[model samples]
Target: MESSSPPADTNRASTAEGLRFAFGTLTVLPVRVARWDRAAARTGMVCAPLVGLVVGLVAAAVGAVLLWCGASPLLAAVAAVAVPAVLTRGLHLDGLADVADGLGSGRPAEEALRVMKQSDIGPFGVITLVFTLLGQVAAVAALYGQGWAWGAVGAVASAVVARGALTLASREGVPAARPEGLGAAVAETVPFGAALGVAGCCVAVPAAGSAAVAGSAGQVVGAAAGAVLGLCAAEVLLRRCVRRFGGVTGDVFGAVAEVAACGTLVVLAVL
Candidate 1:
């Protein structure tokens, strides 16, 4: 009789391939993805939070080192904010700027998307970028002033939460804005259960850590509150995107992630 065991090696190879795709697409990380099919793309988006986890940790590490070296909180915060921008090649920031320009134009779906696709930044883009960056810097600085640990915590939490928003956007029934491009490639590829499971883990891990040091109940509640608010911010943006553009695009995905990060940081800083 022959053994009926599953192909463990094949499964492992597939997972590794998926991870490479995720990091390659989501970050400036030097990873080569060998596959580009629907399954691979779905796996990549599902695994996006893993990239966020690494990015957040690196960002926090930079801020912590600077603070230890006697840098001011503001400077450290700026460095922290700049690290993600550098790591992702400012892709998310660019998306945020483009989406801002498009929405601010008050044009119809096609016109708005066309405006967003333009290479040049508009006045609305510039204004949105300035305020958003300033808000992130200020929030991180506030956390840093409280303590380096707090800053680090907030950094990690926000990054993970932001990517969680992307996971949300990737779920089934979330239509793509265009029939081509990144949106079309990965749109509605993620199963609702997968998105929910990843999102819950992303939201819960940080909250659990907070509970460990600062007592269970209050810390958990605070983290939950922040996560809820962050998700809400992303949801509102998603709704508006659907209304204005007919569905989420690659740029809209990035915009949701950035907005969720900002919302998470603001909530953490306040609470």
Candidate 2:
């Protein structure tokens, strides 16, 4: 029998090593982490979207299968949208809800963080989840109307772009809300260049791929623009999160990913 990979608690670092940590920590899939040190976490966050690449591909496959079965666009869209949430155990959506609850509470920073920590969802959280999920469903459904091929492109791109936002959230100057936890471990570990490179690579993938599939430079440009806009939207929310909660946290990363993804889908449909 083959030996197992190292346990998740070990400390190590490298892009290759980071891939294990990223998949293990971010997804329900059982990719073993090489180690869990700060180096691993930083690289893990940097390589975060690599996990999304697989996620997007899987989501595209799910949508494609539903369409192949003669399902309506809306039905196919719902399944496609649900795939990532199911895979990630709804981690990003939960963060968006927590952030909504925290900011909407209109309390002080410490109080807001406390509100987010609670196990129960608040009214703000509930409302945000409803609208955000609705927006994703609506947008993907619209894209599917164009064709399942188009829908597949949008689904995969949106997944990657959403995960890309987490890298931006970790840039230098972003503070951690507390002395310990995920925030403290990953915050500032990804420099601006690393974040920019990751974002550029992610946006480029769909743009280049779309051009090949749809055979239009305009479509490629539009997809690229939508991805950038999605990242910008996430940045706006990140600013609010910082001002509201005193800094970034694991929850903040999750919130940014979800919102960015939704925004990307909306733009993809319209553009």
Candidate 3:
């Protein structure tokens, strides 16, 4: 977002650092992050969707291979849904559960944050995890039932949108709830315009590709609409987190990603 032209070498180095930061922080990948400052975080947040693309492709590949092996749609869907979780080491899912418990605790902000930091999941957390996982699996299964391509497109689109939501969440003015940890390290690193531009590009490519594959105008419209609605859902949760928890945390980021991904899958399945 900084418009001042820097040296080409510096630009290349920064981009490499950012990519390493994005992959290292967001996934269980072996990439080592060489920098943790705002400059790297800014680029990393912009590159978050790229990480999602890889994750989605892996998930799609697993499902496609399972289907080719004569596995049932339900089983393939389960594998697809499980792939991202495994790749991320279940961090996003755990965050989703923690956020659910925090929000549902009926405690004050400080107390709720403490509740979320506990080692064990509360009842609300357990319930939220169960429903979210079930919803994702069922929706993917429905798409797989339609056809392998449809399911693959849905999986990839949902993942890309999910990570794109993280980019949006990192935009300027979104404060970190605490002074330390991941949320603090990356919060407000991305510029608002940059975030939107990245999100628009990420959403458009998949939507257009889905349409091209399906050979239907409706598919493009549906995919775009689904992405928009999913982002809106995540934004609502983000606002709530800011209001209730004081601002965003690492858990909030994870919760936002999973919610956006699940919402996108549901919309894709229906439309």
Candidate 4:
């Protein structure tokens, strides 16, 4: 008779696989995800912020180089905003647009989800994408106008928080809207406390470093406040999507990330 516990290697957790899964699914990065099981999803969600960190750094580097090359803050900001889109192949933006159309359709859950899966974007999607992109560019420009360092900080901080929001969305008890797809694969893969721990680190680490560089306690407070507000905005959207759709979907995750990034950028620009 076979033993009850199965093989030791069956569910073995690998950080490398986790990173690959995170980068592979989240970005246009070439990393191959070797596993598609719950174990992989669990590790991937927890490591999502690492993908954000790299994306943010790339975005910041582009903006900073542009600024150094005598580009206007607006132009640099546009580059900064565009880099992540290019890197992720605009996956999150499309999700945001789709989500907007779905929610804006005012139909029942099934109909709305069907609308979301369609190839063509509706008027609601177009309008939402326009304003959201504009908000991001404008906010990045504002931060850049202050200085390159501040602008870099804003780009990096917002990206990390945005992806961290995904981890929260994937935590235990968050059901998937459908029986298949990414939402279902990664649904409830993370422990709630673990998600919170990751989120706290995402907020605290960047805020602390940014404040130190700025040489002000106020900057620390501002950074924390901005991150907190961003996460709060994402949380609101997540709940709304869950309630409206009956659970979370991959599109919902994308929408949540974009909203979190936008919120963080706007708040950082203001404060």
lDDT of the candidates, in the order given: 0.83, 0.85, 0.87, 0.88
Give the higher-TM-score candidate: 1 or 3: 3
Error of 2 at 6 (Å): 22
TM-score for each model? 0.92, 0.93, 0.94, 0.95
Against the true structure, what is every candidate's RMSD?
A: 7.0, 6.1, 4.6, 4.7
Q: List, residue by residue over 154-230, the lDDT tens digit for candidate 4.
A: 89988999999999999887788887788878888888999999999888856875775764787778888888899
lDDT of 3 by residue, 1-271 (tens): 1111111122333788999999999999999999877788889989999999999999989999999999999999999999999989999999999999999998988888899899899999899999999999999999899888888888898899899999999888888887777887778888899999988976785687578676478878888888888888899999999899888888999999999999989988888
| Candidate 2 overall lDDT versus native | 0.85
Q: Lowest summed lDDT over 10 consecutive residues: which window, candidate 1?
A: 1-10
Following a full C-alpha superposition, what root-mean-square deviation does model 4 have from the true structure? Answer: 4.7
> In candidate 1, which residue ranges exceed 4 Å CA deviation?
1-13, 212-216
- Could you give candidate 1's per-residue lDDT for residues 108-219 as a string of tens digits? 8888999999999999989988998998999999989987887888788888888888888878877877877776677777789999998887788568656754635876
Evaluated at residue 225, the lDDT of candidate 1 is 77
TM-score head-to-head 1 vs 4, winner? 4
The C-alpha stretches of model 2 lying farther than 4 A from their native spots are 1-12
* Winning model by lDDT: 4
Give the CA lDDT, 0 to 100, for residue 194 in model 1: 95
Give candidate 4's TM-score.
0.95
Superposed Cα deviation of residue 140, candidate 2 (Å):
0.7
